[model samples]
Target: MSRNVILYIAMSMDGYIARKNGDVDWLEGDGSEPDADIGYDEFYGSIDTVIMGRKTYDQILTFGEYPYKGTRGYVYTSEKRDNNEDVEFTDENVEDLIGKLKKEDGKDIWLIGGAGVIDEFIKKNLIDEYFISVIPCVLGGGIALFKDNNPEIKLKLLKTEAVNGIAMLHYAKR
Candidate 1:
């Protein structure tokens, strides 16, 4: 089977992925009892490769340790950066990169995003699936999950589930 490029991410009810400052502290959700398994572990297990934007990677660095330690990671950027033991920084065209990745024998690829990267992937129709967790909050304004005037791409909802007040929506390109 061809490897799938999955856009797995969380967004606020109003459709913002993060605050204007790129802070996701709101994801904790009213300091209630810790969130239950929203199937993150299961989803993480299905992807061996991760693709993210430089801004997302930089934001992750502020958290100290790299969360995706063992997974093969590719940070998409226009700047020149040396590859580390954890990730390879590249400016390769999204379509060409994804085409090569899909041919490799491995688990699905995770399109971890920060808006710009997601937009590029969407433009090229490279993402095969979307796993979105809708958190319960509205940030009036911030970085949006979907930009205005994007190309219309229809999708089919495959599943929906609620866990700890968070709604998880799974979709496949139609």
Candidate 2:
């Protein structure tokens, strides 16, 4: 079977993934204890590869150790960079890269994002599944999850759930 490209991300109720400055400190739940699972472990296990934009990769580096250990990572960037044990940086076209990966024998791919990569994938209609977790707060203005001027793509809702005050919505291409 073809590997699906899933956009698994959390966004504010106002549709912002992070603050304008790229701070994600607002992704907390209740603050009563440590962060809840929110199905992350389950979802992470279902994917064997992760794709992200250059900025997103840089941002993730600030978080200390890489979170995706076993999964292969691909970082889209124009500049030349050395590959590491965890991820390979490539300047390949979005459509071409995704097409090749889909044909490979592996589990679903995670389209983890920054706005640029997400916008490209959405425009190409390459994403197969979307797992969006809506956080409780609203960042009046920030990095938007969806950019303007993109073609309207329809989706079929697969499931919905609430965990730790966050709304999780699963949808697939229609």
Candidate 2: 10-residue stretch with minimal lDDT = 28-37
Please give me the total number of clashing residue pairs in predicted model 2. 0
lDDT of candidate 1 over 1-174, digit per residue (tens): 789999999999999999999999888544343556678889999999999999999999999999999999999989999999899999999999998998899999999998999998888888899999898898899999998767888999999987777888999999
Clashing pairs in 2: none
Give lDDT: candidate 2, residue 62.
100
The list of candidate 2 runs beyond 4 A from truth reads: 31-36
Each prediction's RMSD over C-alphas, in Å, is 1.3, 1.4
**5: Cα error in model 2, Å:** 0.3
**TM-scores, all models, native as reference:** 0.95, 0.95
How well does candidate 1 match the true structure in TM-score terms?
0.95
**Model 1: residues with Cα > 4 Å off, grouped in runs:** 30-35
Per-residue lDDT tens digits for candidate 2, residues 1-174, read 789999999999999999999999998765543566678889988999999998899999899988888899999999899999999999899889988987789999999999889999999999999999998898999999999888888999999988778889999999
lDDT of all predictions: 0.91, 0.91
TM-score of 2: 0.95
